[model samples]
Target: MNTNPFKFGTVVDDEFFTNRKEEIGKIHSILSSENHLILISPRRYGKTSLISKAIKALERPYIFLDLQLITNIEDFTSQLLQKTLKYYPFEKIKHFFKSFRIIPNISLNPLSNEVDFSFNPTMSSSVILEDALNLIEKLSTKEKKIVVIFDEFQEINKIDKNLDKKLRAILQHHKMVNYVMLGSQESLMKEIFEKKKSPFYHFGYLMQLDKIPYEEFFDFLTERFEKIKNNGSGLSKEILEFTKLHPYYTQQLAFNVWENLIKNNSEDIKEVILNSVITHDNDYERLWGLLNKTEMKIIIALAYERKSPLTDEIRTKYMLGASSTVFSSLKKLIQNGFVVKINSSYEIEDPFFKEWLLMRRAN
Candidate 1:
């Protein structure tokens, strides 16, 4: 199947596109040293794609675990063990695990060819995480540097209230392997790594993944779109410029517009492109429903106006009760991922969503 040049809804591997040479370089620098990294970005900003791509460029044997899959401590332990074993020699899989004094239960599923190991602790034992790190450390000691990328690291907070600090202390001591913790939720990720009182504070280098440049992304997509159509219906410079303003919309818009053009065998793509944008705007009804009445008012107001930090005047103008109410709603919107706070000002993060809000307010 052909892949969209502008992938909005999913993560893309390094092979799928161009650009990000600088990001790859930053990651390379982090791995070159003994330090770990905390990668942060808003949702759908390509954090996962960047790190996965960086792993491919690195020389080390790497394990990429999406922490979203982990639930309890046991699940975390099992996934780490499985990933560590993936790098081991085929003959060493079962036999080598027998030596882990920390892990006790070992069962093999012949059908799936996956072995499971469980660790049983004596009463009053409290070193489960340390032992697990030691197991990974031991795996890394065998002439191979192991780089573990924990995607959506913030979600681990949901696993155990104290698990974040527990894992931090273990990661702080491990010297044999490189770790990269990645998360897209800004507030949670920041609270994990930025607070000095937190266990992970200053524990790793910081890498922020920004969107691709407009012109560069435009040229890349234009070439791809032209090739895919064999120049039957080429993207005009106007449409390309519109795409650059909204990164996520670019991919979704291109997908919708190109699909229609190909289906109808039409040489003119403008009408279909406009219709795609309008359709995307109509999808904002879900966002409106998710927010409360006051949030809806502030959101609609911000969609039409507002250029600075929301103040008393802005709050009154929006018909919100008070500055605190407006501030609370804005905070809620940001935390809920409906909008993003940038430079002390909030803007809807998704381009299509913003367009949808504008249309709804207009109506």
Candidate 2:
């Protein structure tokens, strides 16, 4: 039996990773120059995978922190300190604690053989954040370059409004550390980094990740399916079109197809698609519940047309009510990640959701 080669809902290593050659090279070059980078994409566009691949190509010391897992400033500072100490040399760690005037008791996890440092909780959040910044600066003074990756960095906005300003102030002067801030929320990331009034304005080279090219993805799927000796003929194209080349969904659909193919030699792509939607029915139902009626109509219109909903004919046909309502609903959907603005048009972010909506309309 061939093991399923597709990976979804997690970061895939180079073995299963398909493309992004240009992105990897560009990111590597940016880090090599000790420059900061801001990578933006909608969720599941493989921002994390691209970063992980790029980091593997680099020879520098690096730390990757997922801000989504961090709830507040205290969590951020503690994780920052812990990851820093974990990656830095033991002697340098000792120097770090001494220089920062912080004492942490060290413990080792027997199962993972991982060392963890726990510091006293006497310091304020601001103080801890400042000290963490200081630690990065001090570490940068060493000969080796260090790279720091903040994944889902827009989550910082949830922790504190001033956190961006404070981080920018400290990071602006760091000479030795290169930073890559990855965010899946396009609007928020742009506001944080592109808006002139924001503290992180022009903070780094801004790069937006687009969906994987159709040809590239198709070739990858075809090759992997063939390697497993599975008769995946015509399935790759179907999966790509159905998933709209969204990385996560493509992998997920492909995974289901592979499983069905193995179990029953079933090549019914549409069945796999239906099963996938049905599996996530509850989550989709909850997502639908979150939107108001106007928003729902806009999404339905977009799902049906897959074009600009602001057009007169589309508005009339969908009974989108009024121009102002359409505009507000579209804005809300885009901001809330239910819809995405593609080139010259808008699309439902989740292709399966689009399918589900179409099925509902037909019913």
Instruction: Give TM per candidate.
Output: 0.86, 0.93
Distance (Å) between predicted and true CA of 46, model 1?
A: 0.6
lDDT of each: 0.71, 0.83
lDDT of 2 by residue, 316-343 (tens): 9888888888888887788889988777
> Which is the leading candidate under TM-score?
2
- Where model 2 places Cα greater than 4 Å from the true spot, the runs are 101-122, 141-143, 228-233
C-alpha lDDT (0 to 100) for residue 86 of candidate 1: 73
Residue 247 of candidate 2: its Cα lDDT? 92
Pairs of colliding residues, candidate 2: none
- How far off is model 2, as Cα RMSD? 2.2
Count of residue pairs whose backbone atoms collide, per candidate = 0, 0
